[model samples]
Target chain A: MGRLLERLDKVDRRVIYILMAASVIVPLALKLDFPIPIGSGPSMDLYMAIDTLPPGSTVIISFDYDPSTKAELQPMAVALTRHLFGHGVRVIGMAMWPQGASLGQQAMAQAADSLGAEQYEDWVNLGYTVGAGVSLLRMGSSIEAVYPQDRDGVPYDSIPLMRDVRRLGDVDLAISLSAGDPGIHSWVMMAKDTYGVPVGGGCTAVSAPEFYTYLGTGQLVGLLGGLRGAADYETILRERIPGAPGGLATPGMAAQSISHLVIMGFIVIGNVAFIAGRSKRKGGAK
Target chain B: MTMEIVGIWLGALLTLALYSFLYRDNPFYKFTEHLFVGMSAGYWVIYNIYNVLIPNLWDRLVGTGDAAPDMMMIIPAVLGLFMLARLVPKGAGLSRISLAMIVGTGAGLSLVTTFRTNCLSQVEGTIIALTGAGTGQFLSNLILVVGVVCGLVYFFFSKPHRGVIGGAANTGITVLMVAFGASFGYTVMARISLLIGQVQFLLFEWLPTIPIFRGLTG
Candidate 1:
């Protein structure tokens, strides 16, 4: 028993990696799905904010993440676009991260294609601009000055959707789907606090807690954090919007649930082995 | 045959190659790593040139169409050149001017904004009335107030923790640990979510492309 405990304590790292992989793969292969409960948290808040917007209300959704974080953030971009377009809200897409331009385009394309939303009329992609926080601050004054031309090289003034949208303050609400710096933080500081524009955010789960303080201060109107946050938004959409297609994050949550359990099990085993090995060593010394 | 299929195949092969590092580092993993780095670097360089440099600097300076050349753009263009001066030994000192400008402007902007948003607003949020609230809200407010106070106490290094201060500090440590534990749990969930994404792609996206494995996807 002691030897077994020792071996368990020193189990090969590869075994854990394999277990983790299996935890994710098995559930996915089996097509397992779990019910996603919509809580009265930030996700719901975000949903309600967009849902309550009157038709023709304009909103800016900044895709501030790259492909590395696409797994976590892309669902958010798609879901936000769906909700905005469903409400007949004019959507303006932009990005702080350079790679976010194409990622945003892909997400918007997916959502737009499904909903029959037109580009440059119902929506416009402003593409990416350099200068993270500084650029955001500049947008507070003049968005057109910052992005004189849309992603397609069309003059900003020529785009019907961007005609009256002069600055960040002109928008109803600004939502930043952010992976890191110049994301939620930049929006809160530059757009919300400085410009007094209502701001919301969706961020990777790891950075979610760091932004909770802003929620308390009412700097951020709502937040969607990680896959669970995306799942929550999807749940709200599924319930609210008629014939709203299911999102990627909801199906992924089942795998997340299983993987979390696997990790918890490993933690338990590791702790038990450590305690047992420690007691055995003390007994031998005595 | 199609571009989509070719892209998926390349992505799948690369994903498998990168995952090979799980067992042990090998040539495949190294090759993928180097390819990713090289590709990312090259992509960004081109992206910046087109998205930032040409439109913002070059076009503005040289003028496009009816607009005459804006000589005022020369200030920033020269500053940018000064920034690149750090690569040469003799010109390295010139980089300080641009660096100083950046640091000064950033500090100035950040100070007022950070003070307003992070410090003042957070304090205002914490100082909310403990009364005039529902049961759940009241409890939440109380916890917030206590947590903030105790957490601050823990960081108050000037006074040595003893007696009541010690107890408060201990509670502070507990609160901090709970916060850290929650953060760590979220981090784990984030990582697991990324794994789930990759697995979904492999199973649903990559697998369905193969005739034999198509059934496995369904």
Candidate 2:
């Protein structure tokens, strides 16, 4: 028993890695999916914030993440755009991260298409703004000043969507889907605090807890933290918009939950082996 | 073969090569590592030149017919040139001016914004009324207040902790441990999600090319 516990303590790392891979791949291959329960958490708050906006109201979405976090944050972008466009809300899209510019355009385009909305009329891409928070501050006073032209070099005056959104203050709500800096924090500081605009958004799960204080402070009206948060937001969107299809976030969340349990089990077993080995050593000493 | 099929095979091979590090560092892993680093560097250089330089710097310096050239743009143009001086031995000192300007501006902006968003606003949020809040909200707020206050106390090292102060400090440590544990769990979840995404790509996307896994997934 003593030798066995010791061997378990120093189990081959490859075995653990293989098990971890199985935990993820098996659930995915089997099409294992868990239903998302509706709850009044941050994701719900974000949904309510957008849902409450009247039709024809405009919203600004800051795509502050790049390809690195697409797996985690893109679902939020697609779902949010879907919700907004489905409900007839105009969207002014922009990116603080250069890589996000194209992704933002794709999300907006897909959402608009699904809802049968026309481009440049229902939505416009402002492209990647260079000055970070400074650009956001400029947006508060005049969106036209910050982005004289759209991503395609079309002047703001020509885009029908830009007609109503002359400044950040004019928008009903601002949501930032961010992976790192110049993201939600920048939005809160430059847009919300400076212009008194309400802010909500999603971020990677790692940064979620750091933003909880902001959520509590009401600086961020709501937040969707990581893949779980994206799944939660999808749950609410499906409830509100009947027959909405499940996106990448839901399957990602299902796999993640299963892997988390597997990891937790590993932790418990590792600890038990450690305790058992220590007791055996003490007994030998006696 | 279709380009899509070729691309999938290439991606699967590269993914396997990268995952080879799990066993031990091998030639394949090193090759992928170097290729990735080289590609990323090249990609970012082109990305920045097209995204930032052409539109921001070049356009401003040599404006089109709709916008007149501003001679003032020469200042940034020169400063930007100075930034490249670091590659030369003697002219390296000249890079300090541009670097200083960048650092100074970044620091000044971050200081005010961080203070307002992270400090002042957070303080204002904690001082909410206990009366109007529902029982659940009140309890939540109470925990917040206690957690924040005790967490702050844990970091207060000005005086020696003893008696009542010691107890509060200990409680603060407990709160911090809970916060750390939660943060760690979040980090694990995030990493696991990324892993799951890759696995999904392999099993569903890459494996579908083979007949066996195609039906298995479908």
Candidate 3:
């Protein structure tokens, strides 16, 4: 038992890596799914915010993340697009990050394709605008000033959906799917505070706590935090839409839960081994 | 056989090559690392030239069919050129002008907004009425108020921490530790989510393309 404990304590880092990989891969292969509960928190509030929007209401969804955070943010973007289209809301997709433009296009395309939604009519991709906060400030006055043309080089005025949408104030709500800076902060400061447009965001889990202050201050109407947040939105969609397709984030929750448990167990074992080893050394010295 | 399949295989093989570092660093890992860095650098250069310069700078300076040329764009264009002066030893001082302008503009823009949103509004948010609140709301409000006060006390360096101040500072440390722990846990989850994403892609998307492994995936 003593030798086993010593070996476990001194286990190779590769062994831990393999365990983590197996934890993720096994659950995914088994198609394991856990129940996703919808609590009256930011995720629920975000859903309600969009759910209450009338048909034909315009909403700007900004993809402020790139492929680096695609694992967490992309599903939220796709799910949000589907929810908006399902309600007949006219969607304006934009990106704050450079690479986000293509990622946003792909997400919207996937969702739009399934719903038979027409681009430039039901939705338009504005692509990536360069300036971070400055561009956001400019957008508050005139969106056309920043994005003179859409991603495809079509003039803004030529797009039917964008004709009436002139500035940030014109939109009913703005949702930012962000991984880092020039993101939720920019939206909250410019769109929500400066322009008085209702704003919400979907961010990586690491960023969730920082944004809770915004939620408390009522600057953000709602927030979708990380994969769990995405799963919650998927749950709401599944419950409401009857036949809503499954999302990538929901399946990921099983792996997330299991991996977290494994990590916690390791933490406990590692701490125990350290304490036990320290006591044994002390006893020997005495 | 197809372009799509070829792309999938390429991506899968590259991902495996990068993951090979887990066992031990090898040629494949180094090659993939260099390839990723080189590709990203190249992609960004072209992306900036076309997405930024051509549209914003070039189009504005030289009229693009619908709009007339704006000569005022020259000022910003010059300032942007000054930013590259840092590369030259003698011209490095010229970059200071561009840096100053950026710092000045950013500070000027951020000062009012940061004060309004982060400071005043946050202070306003902290001043909640604890008396009339329900049990849950009361407890939450109390925590908020205590947390803020203790946190501020911890940062109050003017006075030496002793007695009540010491107690408050200690409480603040606990609160800060809890916050840090939560952030760390979320970070762990975020990384795990990324891993899950890669694994899912390998199993569902990439494996299905291979004939032998097709049965392994749903």
B-chain TM-scores per prediction: 0.96, 0.94, 0.95
Kindly indicate the candidate among 1 and 2 with the higher DockQ: 1
* Highest-TM-score candidate: 1
lDDT per residue as tens, model 2, B165-207? 7888888999999999999999998888778767777887898
Give the lDDT of residue A212 in candidate 1. 91
Order of all candidates by lDDT, from best down to worst? 3, 1, 2
Which parts of model 2 have CA positions greater than 4 angstroms off? A282-286
| Model 1 spans > 4 angstroms off | none
Q: Which ranges in model 3 have alpha carbons more than 4 Å from their true place?
A: none
Q: Each candidate: what lDDT?
A: 0.90, 0.87, 0.91
Candidate numbers sorted by TM-score from highest down: 1, 3, 2
- Give model 2's docking category: medium
The model with the greatest lDDT is 3
User: Can you rank all candidates by DockQ, best first?
Assistant: 1, 3, 2
Clash count list over all predictions: 0, 0, 0
Compose the digit string of candidate 1's lDDT tens values, residues A1-286: 8788899999999999999898888888888889887768999888888888899999998999998888899988888999888889989999999999899999888888888899998988999998878898999889988998888888878899887889888999999999998798888989999999999999999999999999898898899999999989988998988899999899998889998998999999899999999898899999
Whichever of 2 and 3 has more DockQ, that candidate is 3
